[model samples]
Target: MDVSRTRVLQLIARPDFPEPYERLAGGSVWLAEDVERWITEHQPWKADQEAEEEP
Candidate 1:
């Protein structure tokens, strides 16, 4: 997500973010597609940037 760890923690804490897929002993896990969808919807500019970054 190109965000600082602290910022990612904050984003995931938001009510609109997707519910985590699982909670491991280490940390929570989320489906990439779910997060990608959320980013595409809420951060379209980021989605565009990511798409441009890919080969």
Candidate 2:
């Protein structure tokens, strides 16, 4: 199975995206459920962060 580096990077960078379990091992952190929980718990904070980044 071949995966593009760009696509893999995108998944790692996005907070709302769900990553595969295998990816979590071998120092590739961030679980899918954790991301979901973070989004749920910090929706306002996440929005604020995005808003602050925008012009």
Candidate 1: C-alpha lDDT: 0.94
Worst 10 residues of 1 by lDDT: 1-10
* lDDT digits (tens) for residues 1-55 of candidate 1: 3689999899998999999999999999999999999999999999999999999
Stretches > 4 Å off in candidate 2: 18-26, 29-55
- lDDT string, candidate 2, 1-55, tens digits: 2459897686567765555456444666667576656655656576566557778
lDDT of 2 at 49: 66
Query: Candidate 2's error at 30, in angstroms?
Result: 6.7
Best by TM-score: 1
RMSD of 2: 9.7
- For model 1, the stretches where C-alpha displacement exceeds 4 angstroms are none
C-alpha displacement of 25 in model 2, angstroms?
10
